[model samples]
Target: MSFAKAQDLLRLALMASTRHFGVSLEDIRAEFSVSHRTAQRMTDALELTFANVTKQTGSDRRSYWKVDDPTIAQLQPHQETAVEALEIASRRAKEEGRLRHAQALEDTRNGLMLRLSARDAKRAETDAEAVLEALGQVTRPGPRVPLNQKIADAVTEGLRGPFRLEIIYSGRSDQARTIEPYGLLLGPRSYLIAKQPDRGAELLNFRMDRIQSAKCLDEWFIPENGFSIENYAAQAFGAYHDPDQLKEVVWRFKPEAAERASEFRFHPKQTLQYQADGSLIVRFTAAGWLEMSWFLYEWGDAVEVIDPPELRDFVQGYQRADFPSLP
Candidate 1:
């Protein structure tokens, strides 16, 4: 093989090893348009050259090849940031009970890290770690997921499914329901966002832990027309939403808290205005007054509600009797 052909075969062989289902000789031939003999030569070269590469024999005695180690391959400086990102994603997934995804991310991270030695790895790692540390300092941490393995798996599986799953949900008691899943959202917890045509056409959020059992139905359901998960999630102030009850909310922050409040993100679609008086005005339109109220409560006396009487009422409702009155 020419130098270029050798490089191409090495790249192909390395990728094949990452798959649990090893690539067959036919797979290489079909993908790279190489003949059976050429495919065998590439496979043999990979096994002989790389310590991590492996060959598995199928029941038919045909051999399959896979990349035993991707991380062992050297990483360029730009690749360091990509490695750092995958590490963060893996940590996030682990916190959210997505073990399979977390593990996969870690494996990828580990493989990348292996390619670097302490001497040549210094500068790129420092830059990437700095970015990750900044995000860790500012972002509010999500709650550790409380969902069981099976329920978590079901919710994950339903995301791409055209299947209506039969689920036994519990509130006052266990009751059966059929739902066509739209997507899932992860924040403080995980929710399976779906719709039930039997109940109403409106979409609903089901807490993953509350689902007693779920089974996929034989019948498949199509996703709603023009429905996008990104748009759906953007409509909520947080994880909760009252689709029809959305209202514009305004809050004024005192100078002491204005800087901090201005730096925070309360809603996906929110705007801020810094006043000449060093105060800040935060504005957003969304629903879930109770959830909104809970957030504003965190600001204490530093933040003042300026509009939407209902939100003020909800916040006022949480007040304790005999507390110091404010003007």
Candidate 2:
């Protein structure tokens, strides 16, 4: 191994031994694949000086060195300092180009001193200030909803079963509606999948973002057999739609745009077929008209709806009304 690589390994060994096994020279050398002399040299090189080395005699009359340092006992240089220093340096490097040069200097000094270099210390202080500034900008100067804790309690209630919840849900129309929550759907975003008792059999999905408040009700509900949150959420494109209305909607992508569509499977049910003119045929079902509208809007002129005349008409109407001048 190179000298630098060997030094790194020796440093790691010393750190591990000091932190975990109370800094036994024999343990450091054996674990790090280094000579006793090399291990002794490493201990001497460390910034934190080891004091009171006691010689212990074992059953076989072998001698061992025991390190006694209260500082070593309290401060774990590797775990507490080194990793944090590297992270701070990396963040500063990304945000401020000039800071990277300073961070590099600090990292070198940290390797030698076993503490954050002066530059790294400054970077850390700057990071703290930046964090506080960002927090000040984003944080409202009023009481905020404890969303994470509320979600955790809701999840616990759902898992334990026999639970019903009342949530002040905001709809896509930005109308607030009160409903009894059936269960929660943990999606790319979290959702409360609740049945609108007033609406009758209409399963409404309330985005956690749009939910103003939720309260557990006195009544309990039993989830139906074969009902799964993952399966249900995966069936639709976005959180708002349902998957029960699966109808094969086909679209033809122009040759230039074909590769883009084929690059990633946009939907689990998506199927790609090459057309005669080198174009691509992408087929996937929509749970409702909402997802269909989104797909058509996103693909634009690069895609043409081939099947489901209603979808073609929907796109045509949008084109005529929205972009009448465009071909």
Give one digit per residue, the lDDT tens place, for model 1 in 1-327.
Answer: 688876676567556755676788887888788899998887777777777667789887878777767673432334667777897898887776788789899898777766677654665568768878777534555455566777666666666567788798889757789899888787667788899888898999988767899877777777889998888887777778786657798999888778778778887788999999999999988877777777776666777888788778667645433424322
Worst 10 residues of 2 by lDDT: 318-327
**What lDDT score goes with residue 95 in model 1?**
70
Q: Which TM-score value belongs to model 2?
A: 0.46
For model 2, residues 1-327, the per-residue Cα lDDT tens digits are 578855554454445445533455676677767898987766555424434544456555554444544453443233334444555555544333234344565676456444555665666556655654454223323333223456446544644565666565555544544455555654335666767666876666766656665666667765566676666665666555744455677888788778777886766778899988989998876556566676567565777878677667767745222332221
Q: What is the lDDT of residue 166 in candidate 2?
A: 59
* Alpha carbon lDDT of each predicted model: 0.76, 0.58
Look at candidate 1 and tell me the lDDT of residue 88: 86
**Native-to-model Cα distance after best TM-score fit, residue 122 in candidate 2, in Å:** 15
lDDT of 2 at 216: 61
Clashes of each: 3, 0
Candidate 1 RMSD to the real structure? 12.6
TM-score of 1: 0.64
